[model samples]
Target chain A: MTLKRLLSERRAAILEKWRDRVFACYPPETASFLKREADRFSNPVAHRLTEGLKGIYATLLGEAPAAEVTAQLDEVLRIWAVQDFTPSQALAFVFFLKPIIREELAGELKADAGLTAELLDLESRLDGVALLGFDVYMRRREKLSDLKVSEMKARISGLLRRVGVDPSTL
Target chain B: MSLPKPEELARVNYQPPARGWMEVKPDFRPGTYCNAASPKWLEWIDYPYPRQWSVAEEDWQLPENWKEIVLEGMEDRLARFRSLKLFFDICVRCGACADKCHFFLGTGDPKNMPVLRAELLRSVYKRYFTRIGKALGELVGARDLDEKVIKEWFFYLYQCTICRRCSLFCPYGIDMAEMTLLGREMLASIGINIDWAMASVAQCYDKGSHIGATPQAFKDMIDFLAEENERITGIKTPVSYNRKGAEILFVTPSGDYFADPGTFTLMGYLLLFTYLDLDWTFSTYAAEGGNFGWFVSHEMGKRLNAKIYHEAERLKVKWILGGECGHMWRVCNQYMPTWFGQVPSFLEVPVSPVTGTVFENARVHKMVHISEFTADLLRHNKLKLDPQRNAHIKLTFHDSCNTSRGMGIFEEPRYIIQHVLPEGHFFEMPPNTIREKTFCCGSSSGINANENMELRMQGGFPRANAVRYVHERYGVNHLGCICALDRATLPTLLQYWVPEVEVTGITELVGNALVFEGEIERTTDLRDRDLVGVGEQEGGEEEE
Candidate 1:
């Protein structure tokens, strides 16, 4: 019913679609590795395999991963190899994992009959957040909270300016 | 009279600030921003509408119901080129080319991505010409052809420098720049044109040059060169224009005719030719060697090139040697033979009158770059050199993209530098970004005139950073390049972002090093001297 719940739902839907497509493209070993990794969310090895899957997803979506991403991944794995549970800890804290979890949760909310109307309202809010996030991501990557607040501020300013009430004056 | 110090050379004091013309409403609710869910993001985002091109009102008139004519012309051209068809069909939407682009890498703008940029044109070609595209429109993710799309194509296609760096990384060897050029040609048929390109094409047709200098201007340029030739060498190099029966027809970009550093380079070409006693004459008729229309369209390209061939025929020269201009040589050396007939048999073999070493199989008629010509002269001990004249500054060569990559003229320019300024420093930018993979002047496509200054600056910043890097690392102060376009455009960038580095035509540096036959006078008051101190500590080397 909440905006976060709605985003989760939409993301889950998208992920389902993405998984199907990825399965079509990837080899059997990669597909099985991804499937097992996706289910074992707490395990560090599973987390790494999931991270690799995310990279494959980004590449498939026509977004070339930056060189920094590869270096960061390598650093995380190297540190993890020396310390048990470190890979899982890093994966749990990985910036991109939050979106995947939110999307899966939102998908679950969509399946609930009582939350349908609330889910719809949440979807509308999620839409604005997603749009702003994507636009910023195209130029730069920013945290979800930062993206949302900036979008809200920009909107408020635009409305104020249109009504001849300068937000800066306020 | 002495030239002002490099610090005193007029700086480009122009900057375009962001105007508050467009308003973005942050709160406006668009549907959920599902990049995968919504197809809109996949569709081209048309932003910053194209400015209405200000040409003559009559020029705006569609050529006697041009819509039909244009449609027919597009069909024929699209059908004629199998390469275009193969290129459009082969791209697998791989993102390998995204980071490889200097433009995309610098700006992080998705539109600059080579794959995305190619799609701007490719989408239209699919919709209009291909049958599969028409049947499965949005389902196959194709958009209908429209006026708005056409305008966006024009704006973005010109943004490409045709550097062909993306082609190197493309798995299928698909040249997006080539597609962009072809798209421009198609648009030109429909009365869509850029004034900068059209004006250049018209100038080449009327004034025997892209810059539109008259015969008198050429003579005046030569006269000025003669004076400098006397000053530098104490030898009066007899430079003449439109002189018939000369063994070779010397052609250079018109930038050399009017600009200072370019003029010095022209003098070096003249002095070297004289020292070698190779009979060469500058034709006032075809004074300009580079074709701007090559960036615009093929028809205009053919029209501009006709003048060069016509002049070559009229002068009845055995061979035509092009000066150190980038795209000009690419056009002449690579494209000219295909467009024009086989270069004349006599023109094919360039026998150096000095050494009589015949350059055999010169289909584009035994044309030598000024650097090669000068290097040949230096190899034979033809020019008197004083390396200390160059000692006032450290020098390095920036291989012009077209000359190095397009023609493989890497050694000759270096040969001239080693021979003339043996003591001068020559530093190389990282291998991938220089020589063959040289970044464009950011304004070389001829589309980045005053109107698109922001785009030019963004695209050019990476190259400026490279020059700044070499300047910082090796304490190389002077950046010598063989391309006239680089000579003209790179300086503005250096002035804006990397003001410390001075760019010169390699020939000009050679001219500076030449020991004239007269009085020895040490003059350091040249304008554009010491504008920026070499190796001023700043940001350490950072990769773009």
Candidate 2:
């Protein structure tokens, strides 16, 4: 079978492993709560992570366009960007899928050269996703910086106008 | 392969440290804390022990007598405020309030728990003041005050928005916000203050508003808003500032003068005041209704709040009409008369000039909430309203925490909303998340700084989660709130979590629904967004 077909066949197992690795980045107490809570409104972080991961895995298996995958990454990484995570740590979850995919399809890849080439291609796609996650993360960080400047400008616009300086120019 | 395994690329530590919470020092992470008070503002306000300090540094550069000052401050507060001493003395630790905090729910940090957050100060109270705590020490859940403890207090206390959701769940009725207020006051005594609050305090002290709008700037902003109102509704609303003979002096948070969303609410006020032809004036002095002093100390609160009554006497207004604000109402409703000994004799109890309704609820403070005033107008049919004007929006109300819990003025805004919107257009968020159990905007009480966006995001998650629910389930695109700070912060909070949802002040909706006699047919709401169903033709370019 092709690598994409194999990943599709073992989608549940791979998504489960990926979810654990991503959830493990939080504290133990928080990690377990995120795992146990199923209500979306009650535990939004976990809900967002779950829905985003499912969308990402489905899109990665060629069910949707590549832009759909970036949209999924944006939803997940937006949470991590503002969270207590460094840049590397924030995007690390995308890479975690690589190890899970390798382990889940280890036997098929070793038996066939075509499957091994396809696995390399898939790993490269995963690397692209990680790079896309970096873009998503930076967008959020830039938005945060813009928000800071906007908040300051909004706070002081009246003062700026009084002193003969246009706040909009700032 | 020459490289290490892909699984080992990241080191994930899910386990917390083995040490108990008391032993753990606060992690001074960037983006999670606000900066220290500036010496310039400290000097402006004459805060004691004014000096430079940063929470990120190892040494905080506290005063040499910080511990003594804190202890003395505690002792003095305990003697003065009976509520503080009672809250410290009576706590069964039932954990009812442990999960009630939005910060705790959002961050999952044990210290964010209200019981533990209060215990941060209560533990010091135990060791320094109580015999059992001194004799039993850690066994009694008490620890001696130290530099690290002070630092931890700064981190955790500021994390709380002082929303008072926890006090609702407490069996003992412990006002945990009072503890946070007193803890923050003690910290302020030792020259530890955040710049977000101090800057406003300094500005309000000198320039008459939190954003420091001068008398001219305030008028210019009103003129600008009035021009916008004329463009939308074809009415040129007359506005006055510091006018002596005006029957009513309207005081609102200065945020309405400059900021988005809040400025829309200001436009709403101008439209309503013009529609009513009621005599009203905005005060340049006492321009800000939000008391940043309440976030600092009782004395500071009284000092900043004194301007309102002083302006009323000078302007010779009959009574004050407060605009949509959270903590401002808390100060005016609960503490204003007490702080000033009584409402000034120059002002009479507020009787709404249009409806001729005596606001007996505001008898003691002699100030009426705008929502209360508007709801009364709706009840009396004093103004023309067209609910179809708000037909384009799906609405949900976020009860500002202080308005719900502190003042219990819940139904007034809802009553006005009921008259201003169609039946199916407005929906409630969850029953538990509304009214008394409301969550904070997570950036109020002067903690809405840009540097602390992460903390604000996390703390705001619970409230945003509810908004997201209505967004997905009911297609709610608009969130209505009464507080000025909520108007400023909830937009950012909603944009981050639920990007499709937007925030508006309740007055904005009312302004849209309000009909002026012989006025031009409107095509836009207060924010200049196109109104629904007003001019759209079927099968035309306007078809979505």
Error of 2 at B439 (Å): 2.1
Task: For each candidate, report its DockQ versus the true two-chain complex.
Answer: 0.02, 0.32
TM-score of each: 0.65, 0.90
Native A-B contacts reproduced, model 2: 0.31
Instruction: For candidate 1, write residues B191-283 as lDDT tens digits.
Output: 566655656666677777765667876677677666666665566678867788888888898877566456667767766666556788888
Residues B1-544, candidate 2: write the lDDT tens digits: 5564434554344345545778867788888899998899989989887888788889989889889999999999999999999999898888888767888777767788798898899999999899999999999988999999999999998998889999999988999888888999999998999998999999989888877778777788878878878888899988888999899999999888788778889889999999989899988887889999899888899999999999999999999999999999999989999999966788898998888899998888889999999999989988788988888889999999999988888899989889899889888998778899888899998999889988898889889988988988999999999999998899888878887988889998889999988789777777656777545653365576
Clashes of 1: 17
> Please, what is the whole-model Cα lDDT of each candidate in the order they appear?
0.59, 0.86
Where is model 2 more than 4 Å wrong at Cα? A1-21, A36-38, A61-65, A95-125, A156-170, B1-5, B10-15, B343-346, B533-544
- A1-170: candidate 1 lDDT, tens digit per residue: 54344444364564554344323222232234335433221122333334554553343233544433443343233222222222223232232333443355655555666655654444343333323333333232122233334323332332333344544355
Residue-pair clashes per candidate: 17, 0
Lowest lDDT block of 10, candidate 1 chain B? B28-37
Global fold similarity of model 1 (TM-score): 0.65
Best by lDDT: 2
